[model samples]
Target chain A: MTATSFHFGEGDRTLYGVYHAPSVRRRRPLAVLLLNPFGEEAIRSYRVQKIIAERLAALGAAVLRFDYYGAGDSAGECVETSIDGMQTDILTAHEELIDLSNIRRVAWCGLGLAVPVALSAFSSANVNLAKFLGWDPVISGSEYIDDLTASHAKYLADALDMPERRIRRELSMQLTEVMGFGVSESLISDVVDLELNGSDLDVCDDVALIGRKSSGAFRKLHGQLTSTASSVSIEFDESVTWNSHQALNSIIVPNDSIAAIVRALADGDE
Target chain B: MNERIVQFGDDGRLSGVWNTQRKNSNRPTILLTNAGIIHRIGAHRLNVKLARRLADIGFDSLRFDLSGLGESAPAAGALGYERQSAQDISAAADFLEENGRSDSVIGIGMCSGADNFQRAALADHRLSGLVLLDPHAFPALGAAIENMINRYLDPYRWARKFSELKLNAKTLSLRTVRSKSEFSEYGGDTDEQGRLRPPKAEFGNELRTLTKRGVEIGIFYTAYVQREITRATQFFQTFSDYQLEGKVTVNVNPRVTHTYTTLQSQNMLLTEIETWLKQRFTD
Candidate 1:
């Protein structure tokens, strides 16, 4: 396998990343782009992403993993890494993959919000994404904010000897004062507007894999997507567990799973 | 094996160990919080490795238990999310500060300890950084399942009985909620089919507060199923805007679960965190 570092220009800031190419130098059929999660989870899961790139290379597919402008070994600050910047990063990486690897077809695997960014980016760029894999696509950003709030409320109520409703109300007002951006308003409106049925994307023959152990609510959302999008394939893989005991903490993705993905991408060649 | 009781509130005493490399070394402190049902010993091996690693980088570390689990005093009623654990963390921070080890406090926690870091960072301004191993953003599978069973078996009678039990529990001690109706209303309930779910509309309001408080947050997420990481990243990005200076960074380990224990995986994680902390703290 060949691993090399490169940089791409995005206006003033230069986005940095590493490309993993298969050892066998035959022309590749597809290029795989890796999108990571945010915050502490990202720190813990760094190696697994590298392993994925290497495994994909062994399978004869070109793989690429890059840091957003503000994260990893890249330039910029955390505050400057916005949703728009991340989307742009994905688009830039996609172009680099095509140009460097000379691969006409591409597949995207996004860890978290990367999926949405990829979906949104590919659609906007008019890139003919041959395959897509989203690991628990966030249907609504606002709802996720709600989940964070509920967790805090639950803890406060249990700890402070206060009523849960009272804590919830107090926490809400306090959060509003703190967030200043009116996250509650944004979250509420976003949740109401979110549609995960792939209605926002033009890509056909896309597959969404939802972990059975993450949340039943997410599984239900996948079901909704399957029904709404004709070309979208939804599969519930039992190996993926987010919060449950079945979730293996040692490494998020197992070798078998990586092999399975490699097989799937290779099988697509036929 | 080396354990000492560090008292926090009147009745709360945390069982933990303080590993000091040497005198006058000015080492940064690492505070570890244990996972649910797992005692301090369960985390000992991992904590030891972490402590040694941190010490090598010029830092001291402490691993402790919250109020209920391990050797700490048990809560009178349901511990739930261990919200009080934040207080315990504050007390730990105070201990570190008193010993001159609080200048750069980096908290490394699992599950509830991870949650406590989020809460503690809000209260304690002394913390320089936090590392959450495999935190669950939502309730655990067992809790959700129990909630589902309670709702499915009997709605009215169960609610009534729960309320009565809660009232007694609250009256007898410094319990949070006094009645079942109040508890269900606050905790949320399952439908007839028994699926424990969160009311996103209401919960979003609370997260807005946590994010706005400017706590540096990092996540090591293992996406088992498809789109798990995507959903999590979206949540963080949306909320990160409220973070202190808008600093939020995440790395997804593709096939690895929440914890990085494998020799190869752990080394990669350590190197990344070391690099991140060095840059973040120095800058």
Candidate 2:
């Protein structure tokens, strides 16, 4: 596999990405645009996405893994990048991949916050997405924020030798102060408000939802998806851990889960 | 709720239940690991609660008995806690995969059960994640005993006794054997005049080995749990550099005890699991 660097202008800002394609030219059925999680999760899940791209290529698929305006080797600061900018980055990447690979159809895979962001953006932008694979999409920004607050509180309590209750109160205040427009809140709230219960997202012929077994939230989200989407393929792999500490650090891929995704994508084409 | 006799290890088969529920979509398969010495029936209510809650959210979960505990086949040896339980976890995952119910697998274990899951997870990449409730560090047994003694014994007096003994003997070695005569000399197990005893083994080395492996770890602790939260924290911090870039999380449920008796505490754990799964497995 060989990688090439490229930049595109969305509005006044620039988005960067590293494109990976097979050296030998072969007819490819679909091109994939990769969307990643935000903050620390993005950093942790980078290697996994790289592996996924390589595997997809080996399966006769072309993939482009790129960063939003403020992420990775991309230009701009994280604080400057909003949900809208991230969506614009996805759209730009999708267009560039089509032009570069000469492929008409595209598949999207979004992890964590990116899933909801991508879903919300896809609906609004009217992008012709052939299929979407959400690893574990957050349905509620408020719940996610609460989790973050709880996690931060625990971390602070351990570090500062303060009571967890005190830490929780302070963290809540800090998070409340940080909420604003052009922030992640809009993206988060949009996901939370999304009516995931039916087939609305089954806009494409093939849609796959993957999640860790221990996550109740993803299961809930999946329930909503199953209720709405017809011909939507959902597979739960007990081997995959999403929100846990081990997933961030390990190279393990939950082979069964990946295989199921490959099967679903392949079956969709048939 | 369904019961089936499943074979474990080479020649052991035990009766176990398979609880199934239909949700909105196909949710991931969860294998619940029970605590040591706890039978499947003993854990049945709690497991049912957890499974029902997960199903309500869109997941399908199964809680099973480890071999030699509950209804499963008896352990072949005394070290049943580790080997048999690990095998049971592997078997459970295989069962789900074979039944076409799981595309990914997650293991949630309590106490020694958690340790077994950790070992099984290391051996099987099919397991995507692990949730450990009140995991005990091998060294914690000794530490707990020491702490209990320290709470009752006068430290200054013990120190003085040690110093005097060292001065009297050229080389002082306080090794107390548990022979019958020695027990009598120390006034028996319930002693009126007995010396403090040292632990059989130091657990730090074993713990270090476990942390060195690239496995995702989440631990829930209570006041009575063998290992202190500080030890788990230190393990993660010291080995953060060696950890698989993003796959380690250590959490403590302050509202819950080792057993997770309260609904609120259980909810906290469920919430953490949900959030973590969304982040790890979702797009």
Candidate 3:
């Protein structure tokens, strides 16, 4: 695969992305956009996401994995990241991919927290995508925020060998940071209000939810998506946890989940 | 400032982002690599922050991944990881020089990348300076004694020690063996403790040669994790006979982790690096 890394968008809104062109040309080209989770989750899942992009590109699908503004190598700080801004970034990335590849048959593969980002973008924009893949998707933004905050507290407790209760108390006094990245009040306010229903998956013609565990939320969303979407599938293969203190500073390339995602995205790529 | 993607290496496979001043400057280009397998963005996107900040000061930087990591393609040849890393660092320097940028390069690395940077500096004279973060350190008796005393004095350490007592026999044995090894590169020469390292005398000789060649070195150690070096002075103490004080700068920060996970740690590290670069490189 031939990979090209560059900054897209304009001025302070510029975003960074790596576009991987397929090794071999196909009659009908397919494009996949990989959306990342915020903050430390993005860092932890960077390798796995890269691996997925490489694999998907190898299968004759052009892949574009990008950092939203205020995240990754993008033009803003983590504290400046907002859910609304991320939604706009996705739309901008989609336009760039389509304009570059001239392939409108594009699919989005949202990993971890990005699932909600993708859903929000689809609802706010006129994005009638070919397929949507949510791997270890976050169904509730509030839960994700709480989980990350707890992970941050636990990480500090473990690293400093402090009492967990004491760490929790200190963290509660100031909930401005999560796992080392600063959070903006506006971003927090927007994310906390986000709770995705099965209707959120209505933006795509086809949808696939792949995760390590099965939950009532997943079951209900799957059933709901099955009726509204032309085709929908769900798979579970435990390998890695997306957000946890134990997984911090550890590289996890989930081979099983990657394979399932590849199969889902490349289903009709013949 | 301008940032653009660069692919320069064998078969045009190595990937990097070049952050440059809008107008050219005479400052030496900074070369950054992956901290272990964390990719070119560094832990907490520290590389991006550092590169942009350095650009504000008119210094150019290239934050790239070693082959087979991040966006860079894997090497097809049979060269080992360390040898391949050295070659990759040289290639980054070459990219700068060939593009009319300054030939002098300063490498900033942490953990495994620091080890790779030091090795690369030894082989490539183009590297004029190095910022080694949490780099290698041979065990020193004084540092151990100091660390033990500090640990005992900290009331929090008492709680940790009690918890550590609950560790399984296997985990305790593993720690004992690791404690003996001190430090070594991965998949390299090994001994009973672990990877084999040249005797301290030989390592000191290499440092002397680099200093004689006018390579300005900045060595930093962090105690956020269970590191081999517990104190800042331990690095100089490890090679006290070499007389490296005037030629190199050494700092040990107990507040920062190897990865610089917290915003406070990142700020402290970036500030130290900028201050070091200005002091050592200013014409």
lDDT leader: 3
Q: For residues A200-259, could you state the per-residue lDDT of candidate 2 as single tens digits?
A: 456576777877656676677667767654445465757555444345435565666566
In Å, candidate 1's interface RMSD is: 17.3
Cα lDDT tens digits, model 2, B1-283, are 2223244334545434444554422445767755655444222134545554565556666666676443355566675555666666777777776766765677777766666777787667667667776555323444455545654576544554565575535322222233344555543231111222222122223333344553345666554432333344544544444443245566644344455533345556667777766665544
Of 1 and 2, which scores higher on lDDT? 2
Q: Candidate 1, TM-score vs. the true structure?
A: 0.43
CAPRI tier of model 3:
medium
Model 3 lDDT per residue over B1-283, tens place: 2788889999888999898874555678999989878789887788988998887767889999999888888999989999999999999999888888888999999878887898899999999999988666677777678778877898877877776776745666775567456533432322222334456776677778889899999988766423356665667787889978689887877655557767888888888999999887776
Clashing pairs in 3: B189-B196, B190-B196
In candidate 3, stretches whose alpha carbon ends up further than 4 angstroms from where it belongs are: A23-29, A214-233, A242-252, A268-270, B22-24, B153-155, B166-168, B175-199, B224-227
Candidate 1: tens digits of C-alpha lDDT, residues B202-232: 3344334554554455666543211223334
Give each model's whole-structure lDDT: 0.56, 0.57, 0.79
Candidates' DockQ values? Answer: 0.01, 0.01, 0.55
**Alpha carbon lDDT at B231, candidate 1:** 39
Model 1, span A1-270: residue lDDT tens: 666665675675666566887658644687888887543234334555766677777778888887776554455533354566677888888888888788878888876556666676776676778877776566666565566456545543443223558657876674531111112344244333545554654465756454334566566665656665544434446554342222213435454445545555555432
TM-score of each: 0.43, 0.46, 0.91
Against the correct fold, how does model 3 do in TM-score? 0.91
Q: Which segments of candidate 1 are over 4 A away from where they belong?
A: A5-7, A25-27, A150-171, A174-193, A206-208, A213-221, A224-234, A237-249, A252-260, A268-270, B1-283
